[model samples]
Target: MNGCRWMLAVVLAALPVVAVAGCSSAPPPPPPESRAGRPDRGAMLIAQYGCGSCHTVPGIDRADGLVGPPLTRFGARSYIAGELPNNADNLQRWITDPQAVEPGTAMPKLGVSAIDAQDIAAYLYTLD
Candidate 1:
């Protein structure tokens, strides 16, 4: 009986040490920094606004639609909206104000903000 009591006491004494040793929690991950002129963020913003709802964009599935041509080779394409250059600036301008770039088109003014348009251009740049 004494031996059993001593063993139980030893285990009880070690319990607090074990619990304390396992008490620490790991640190959280760092936050991502925003870049105003960045494209991936733009693409993300455009996506968030549901641009993929009517257009075909790679790297983002479930946003596919047959209404517009897929912009798979956007970087390689020479013309956007069939008139303006397919560069970053042009893409932003076109996204920000598509009707202004194209006199008459089915593309409606979704009120996409300027920063979002720019970030979208950055995402399009990744197609290259």
Candidate 2:
């Protein structure tokens, strides 16, 4: 009876330490979602496509441009380049082929792939 009680007390004493160690050893939590529960993949795509050359995008490195309007709050905006609606589908379409959306628009067609466009749109929507 005494041996059992000793073992129980030892286990009880180690419970808090074991719990703390287990939690501390676990991997860190993932980064916060930027938009629509998706991770921030748009930032990389923005740089890869040289988007900063024409527009000033917030949170993107070296995304300062004076030719086009600043995209600081693009996510909150209602329209894309004053033409198409500012939804995911529209954004992807615009990014994939800008000239198709507006032939006369200054934004050229960068030939961005559909997947890259989607990721870019995902990143752009996080500007809010």
Candidate 3:
């Protein structure tokens, strides 16, 4: 009976330590927007927006139009439309309003919302 009581006490004492160790071993959670711009969602949005009608985007069905430059390996590019630097913010801006970035550019203003633009940019970045 004494041995059983000692074993129970040991087990109870170790519970909190084990719980703490488990928590400490886990990586911290990422920021809210860290994964908000998911590539899968972005791809769907691109197809829904008919972006494939102009740019040939990989992994999207019927994205073979030649009106605009092919988006293959777009993530490796250094610039957007050969104008603004290729980055998340710039890409979002260009997607939301192309004319604002370049007055005479052929790209039209699709009026994409900020979140959608972010998702699209995220998907584009995966092209690399």
The TM-score leader among the candidates is: 3
Q: In terms of TM-score, which candidate is stronger, 2 or 3?
A: 3
TM-score of each model, in listed order:
0.66, 0.68, 0.71
Q: Over the stretch 17-105, how does candidate 3's per-residue lDDT look in tens digits? A: 99999989977532222234888999999999999999999999999889999999887787888897677778888999999989978
Model 1 misplaced stretches (Cα beyond 4 Å): 1-36
- How would you encode candidate 1's per-residue C-alpha lDDT over 7-107 as one tens digit per residue? 99999999999888777555533322223478657667767878788888888757697787787867777788788756666777888888898877767
Candidate 1: C-alpha RMSD after superposition: 17.0
* Candidate 1, residue 23: how far the Cα is off, in Å: 74
- 41: Cα error in model 2, Å: 2.1
Q: Rank by TM-score, descending?
A: 3, 2, 1
The TM-score measured for candidate 2 stands at 0.68
lDDT of 2 at 67: 85
Clashing residue pairs for model 3: none
Best prediction by lDDT: 3
What lDDT does each candidate get?
Answer: 0.74, 0.80, 0.85
Local accuracy of candidate 2 as per-residue lDDT tens digits, 1-128: 99999999999999999999998997754332234424267788888889999899888889998888898877788788889767887888888888898888888888898888878877777777
